[model samples]
Target: MKQRGGAYDPFDCKHYPEADVVMRPGMPLAMACTGEKARIVMLAGGRGMHQRLTSMGLGVGSEIEIIRRGSPGPFLIATGNTRLAIGAAMAHKIMVIPMEREIE
Candidate 1:
């Protein structure tokens, strides 16, 4: 994956190279399924995008849950006690590592 600006730690994301990053370890938050929990790993945008996400309490390492999946409008996500409706376009700029659910 060709990220714009964000820290890339091998330990955090594993052995996927920059070119192949989009295939494994992490994926765009927009692609994540509803009800899934994910951790923000990278912001594939410039400083402005980073600042915007940060102001919304969404940054690297932040754990979030997908509340609603959106095909046209904004999608909803919950972080801590806050629920945010992020635009589809902005969601594409946020890369996340989807956490696997434990079998009960």
Candidate 2:
């Protein structure tokens, strides 16, 4: 049985091996093309950054659709019913697996 609010380590790919079996390997969010949908796999940042993103519903396992890709500006992404614009540098720290393909 799973414990609620226990030591949940979302970064452990072993616990979420289905992500790899169904989708491609992870890639930086900034590298994903515009209009692509992907699931967040990892976040490479400190506590504050994690809190900021989590507050905006961008934590690991969240599915996001890229609305626009900004090379030198903030990138627009849609998560749930909310749309967020994050800076390029920040987006680069988020690793995600594209959901555009599925393995049979």
Candidate 3:
């Protein structure tokens, strides 16, 4: 709900509906899924935000991926290219979609 950047009112996203966010597979994510873990190839934020995100292991080139959504909610996530477990509360702060896997 909080818009990290000033491009839009921070409060606007709070009211934004889930359906509005685009979730095309392989496309860059516009927002975090309610219960899907998304691999974070990069993070978009300034200093303070960056620091906070880093605490959650969300940083540039970290490569966090969505595993699955929990029965209650928030979805299980894999963090870093290392692939650690993370909860949805932390994922919500991130705005991401999906990326097409690179062909080896």
**In model 3, which regions exceed 4 Å deviation?**
1-52, 80-85, 101-104
**In each prediction, how many residue pairs overlap at the backbone (N, C-alpha, C within less than 3 A)?**
2, 0, 9
Taken over the whole model, the C-alpha lDDT of each candidate is 0.85, 0.85, 0.51
Candidate 1 residue spans exceeding 4 A from truth: 1-25, 101-104
lDDT of 1 by residue, 1-104 (tens): 23345854543454665556445447899999999999988888899999999999999989999999889989899999999999999999898988783223
Residue lDDT tens for model 3, 46-102 = 677679767766665555556664445545566644544444454444555444444
- Give the per-residue lDDT of model 2 (tens digit) for 1-104: 24447865444556567554465448889999999999998887799999999898789889999999988889999998999998999888898988876344
- Candidates in descending TM-score order: 1, 2, 3
Error of 1 at 14 (Å): 24
| Residue 15, model 1: Cα distance from true site in angstroms | 22
Report model 3's TM-score to 2 decimal places: 0.39
Instruction: For each candidate, give its TM-score against the true structure.
Output: 0.73, 0.72, 0.39
**Which is the better candidate, 1 or 3, if ranked by TM-score?**
1
